[model samples]
Target: MSLAGNRATMQSGIGMIEVLVAIVIMVFAMFALISMQIVALRYQKTAHLRSMASQFSADLADRMRGNIRGAHDGAYNLSRQRYPALGDPAPSCPGPGSCTSQELAAKDIHEWRTGLGNAMVGGWGEIAGSVADGFTVKVYFLDMLAAADGATPVARNCQPTAADPVLHREVSCYAAVVSP
Candidate 1:
């Protein structure tokens, strides 16, 4: 071929190579964008769960403050082990002073527990200490990523000791302290 023709052919081949490189870089950039979106969605879900937990703790604290007598009597103390039976009938308190302090506490707890369970996945709760010495309210929910391993979810006690399941299980907890 002539000199001009040979140079034209080489230039066309180089242009094609550059186009291919640009296309490959664009594909990699698209994949990176998709990965970042997925990570942002996961973090958003986690933040939502944490917000729900904070609301639940605040709710129970308000309930305790409303029933200071029950709170001081230790009637509000609860644990995962003492879950109220779902079938048990709620106490009747249509009028003021219709129920005793303990009865009111029972009713409050049943309502609180039901609401917590309905709002979160695999949710559970506990109340420790008493109004006399201040109190702690804790709400727990399943850890979505950790539970993907297909193991049974367990409730965690924020107060941990040796052999505590909180160390091994897929659970998350939120706790708040309030003095009545």
Candidate 2:
């Protein structure tokens, strides 16, 4: 073959190789971008779930505080009892000083839990073990009101319930100042 023809053939071969290499690099880059997009989507989903959990927690905490503040003597109670296929009765506030402090506290707790359970049933709040996915709120009260010791009697401390099945392990807590 003529020298010019041979050189042209070699140049075409190099061009084909360069095109193939570029295609290969482009394929790998596309795959990497796709993987990164998938990771970003997953992170977005997790953030959404966390936000929902926070909203639910905040609502529950606010309601509990209201109930506690409205209770007599700033002493309230909550129960974790679940009835067998039946709902507990609504709470009735006894006349002032009619019930013992312990009884009043128990009644308050029952009322709080009853309100939470009702919310769950109404689809306004999540319940533990009701679904495989989602979150639950567990309510807890301080052993004693710190404000009882010369502080304002209207002050209260509330904490989220412990970790359990079907609920996230993280807990959130808050304090409420009851209006006299």
Q: lDDT tens digits, residues 1-180, model 2?
A: 558766655633357778899999999999999999987876674445445435555654454444443343434322343222125464565675675654554465455555544533211222232112222343322212222244321122222233221232222222322221
TM-score of each: 0.78, 0.42
Predicted structure with the largest TM-score when compared to the true one: 1
lDDT of 1 by residue, 45-69 (tens): 7678879988988888888889888
Most accurate candidate by lDDT: 1
lDDT of 1 at 33: 100
Cα error of candidate 2 at position 146, Å: 36
lDDT of model number 1 = 0.72
Per-residue error at 6 for model 2, in Å?
6.3
